[model samples]
Target: MDPAGGCPHAVNARLRTRGAVAPVVLPGEVEGAVVLGHEALKDFLAHPDVAKDPRHFTALHEGRIAEGWPLRTFATVRGMTTADGADHRRLRSLVSRAFTTRRVAELRPDVEALTDRLLDGLEGAAAAGRGVADLRRHFAMPLPMGVIGELLGVDAEYRDRLHHLSSRVVATDLGPEEVLAANRELPALLGTIAAAKAAHPGDDLIGALIAAREEDGDRLAPEELIGTLVLMIVAGHETTLNLITNAVRALCAHRDQLALVRDGRAGWADVVEETLRWDAPVSYFPFRYPVRDLTVGGAVVRRGTPVLAGYSAAGRDPAAHGPDADRFDVTRSARPEAARHLSLGHGAHYCLGAPLARLEATVALERLFARFPELDIAVPEHALAPHAGFVGNSVRDLPVRLHP
Candidate 1:
């Protein structure tokens, strides 16, 4: 996938002609590899020989991915994202138990309360100023951070630092050194917290993860324990922040769709789902190394080759959806499982935090529009610049007018 996840014109058109799996030369850490179509992506992910984290990178597998920072801090620990087979199952089970569907459902009131508080502040700021505020900072950013922070039992004070660090880790606009610095800070803080939790486990998810045990009385490795906690925070909030921001931008930019939701022709769920297809929060999944020579979409991805999961590519794929796939239409029939494909990922590596992300975005967006029905973007659509990142799909700031 191109670094510019939202700029889908020529990249999409060119790739569409190359069939389901196209040879692509992506810059930065990614080099030439195959890009999967919607179906191909699902197939690639679920393939028996495919590994979630790239094993081709020797340093990464040992949790020592080279960086300006020390190897101790990289998120390459063999946790859920990187593990395979039994290791993957064990890690996923522990982490998933901490974020059960029951727990996600229990978060509704807290998400609602957090959304309301953020909106109150935004409304006041808009009232005081010229009715303009960077909704990205004031609303989109804080709501998910707040919700995930509380859920993970991170202290309120660490939220700001975590957000700043996560921005560095995910944003492509930043230089390598800056990104490395962000990645460095997180594991240090999280390690200290996890050590404390291991000693005096609390009632929160982090504590639950810290105390989790396997049938033979096995415990999570020190690296996995900390990695799982940090993964939850970054993954939980980062995607949800972008989801809410993208949804608001889509609705405001396409007023006809906004009106459809307002007129009850579609609901918030429709808006969320459509935006997910139109502008996925996670544009590209990181390196997935094939365990052996594998044929994907007729291309032979050699064993140990770095395969990028072109999630954004799959989102608007015409074959999966329809001839009108490129167009973002709220009223289109919900793309069945096989068609829309793996925006939230699929199979064993499916995002455990997805249900919670959806809940937060739903509450945040509904409360936002319900409170300020006439909300409008303060800047021209063209002026809303996105960050220079290969994977993340959020913009810099979503400036909007409350009284507009």
Candidate 2:
């Protein structure tokens, strides 16, 4: 994995030289295999023998994976992301009851309003500065963060802390002690919020989760409640934040592609799908374990070794998306194979927040361009620093001159 995460495609191209499923080093010097081939990823993502439960991981079970290992937080969490089969079904079912289709649909007006409000903030910032503002800070970051915060019923005072801790969760550069401290602080903070919600329950998702837990503690344990909230609050906004930021960056870099949407040759949906493929929001998802020896992309993955889904690499696989796979063409999503990019994931463990993410990104991009049709990158595209982490793929900051 690229520690800088700036040139994941370059890293993937080099890794593909070894094989689709190549051995790699994880954050804690853990040996892992990443499935980089497009078809191989699609197959293994839904493979019956592959599982996500950390219990399947031999290193963790053998006490090799330390408690302070940065990625431990993800695998050890007792949420749908880390569960399998029956347990996964039960946890997902409980969460689905709260995060329903109606709840997501109900957020459209709020998302639109938030988008406009953020755009207004961007205009203000650009006016105060030299006609330049960070789109990531003013627009891309806040839009989804606000929506997810609202959906989860996170209080305003706790949101900054929530965002800070969640960002730490994906950071691969943290030392063991820092990792340990953050791990403790995050759950403690969330527990405080959970206690508050329990005292004054409402129609929000957290209240609904609390109600579910109160109804049957066995169905949704206290740990599982915190884990689920962690998953929702973190995964919800971070992915969408990068998606919107990446989309804006891609469109600005390739005005021809943006013109396709503006000229009706393609739609914003096409841009979203193409951006997802060409530059995935997630570079690598953590830790899937094979139940037994499995041949993935011609490499035999032994049972219990961590397997990472190389979403960034798989998206641009030439075998899957043709010779010009690296190109950022909005028109590419029209192709049948292009529509199958695993940006949102696959199989039973597919991202539960996919609809909300797509909705947020779509609304955000559409409204942002409508508000500032003349928006362009303030600096050269290559100068934009990549977000520091192997898991999340995005620019650290998107400097743009919003010509509103």
Clashing pairs in 1: 172-388
Q: Alpha carbon lDDT of residue 212, candidate 1?
A: 80
Give one digit per residue, the lDDT tens place, for model 1 in 252-286.
Answer: 88889888888988888888888888788876656
Each prediction's number of clashing residue pairs: 1, 0
Q: Which residue pairs show backbone clashes in model 2?
A: none
Best by lDDT: 2
Judge candidate 1 at residue 87 and give its lDDT.
Answer: 85
**TM-score for each candidate, following the candidate numbering:** 0.91, 0.96
Number of the predicted model whose TM-score against the real structure is largest: 2
CA lDDT of each candidate? 0.75, 0.86
Tens digits of lDDT, candidate 2, 219-315 = 4689999999889888988999899999998998898888889999998888888888989999899979999999999999999989989999999
Error of 1 at 50 (Å): 0.5
Q: In the order shown, what is each candidate's alpha-carbon RMSD? A: 3.0, 1.7
